[model samples]
Target: MLTIEQATYDAIVAHAKRDHPDEACGIVAGPEGSDRPERFVEMVNAAGSPTFYEFDSTDLLHLYQEMDRADEEPVVIYHSHTATEAYPSRTDIGLAMEPNAHYVLVSTREHGNNDGPVEFRSYRIVEGEVTEEPVSVVDAFPR
Candidate 1:
């Protein structure tokens, strides 16, 4: 299961809604080896396609370097799908490189940009295998 704060979840959904029609991608970083998602880092979708999402190579490199220096790791990697369900595509499964990170997919097909329901789901993609997971939104993480 992926447990996250409500504010973090809302921020991700907002970013996805803001970038509707084009996939929104980002990451939530936490302390190294920590599964808790504490920091939201919205990213540019290099692909800029409704059906696809790719982090900008330059931005990804810099982000990784910064994370390393800060002793942080990406606990959640997320993207939005404009027209599809909140599920990973074949390409997404093929590109799963973070076995330890939660892969989140948010679908804005039902509501587009207006105020309506969206499909927000989490998954674990490891070595081309996809496993859907449960999500729990809380007010905050315990100290």
Candidate 2:
């Protein structure tokens, strides 16, 4: 299961909603080798397409460099689906290079930019294989 804090979850949903018709993409970073998602970093989608998302090469490089300095790794890779279900597309699966990261998909189809619940789901994509996983949202992580 992918365990995330309620605040982080809310922020992710909000970002998804704010993006509206375009797909919102981001990554949550945590200590290296740790599965906990601690830092939420919203990213600009270079593709700017409702059906696709791409991280700008320069921005991605900067993020990685910063993460390296902080001894952090991307624990969660997320994107919003404006029109489809909260599931990974073939392209998403193909592009997933992080073997240990949780891939999250949020669907805003039911209430585009409105006040309503969205379909938030998590998955594990490794080597082109996709596996749906359960999510646990808590107030905070235990110290």
Most lDDT-accurate candidate: 2
Give stretches of model 1 more than 4 Å off.
none
**Candidate 2 local lDDT, 24-125, one digit each (tens):** 999999999989999999999999999999999999999999999999999999999999999999999999999999999999999988999999999999
RMSD values, in order shown: 0.7, 0.6
Q: Extract clashing residue pairs from model 1.
A: none
Q: Which stretches of candidate 2 lie over 4 Å from their true place?
A: none
lDDT tens digits, residue span 78-134, model 1? 999999899999999998899999999999999998898889999999999899999
Q: For model 2, name the residue pairs that clash.
A: none
Tell me the lDDT of model 1 at 110: 91
Candidate 1: residue 26 Cα off by (Å): 0.3
TM-score of each: 0.98, 0.98
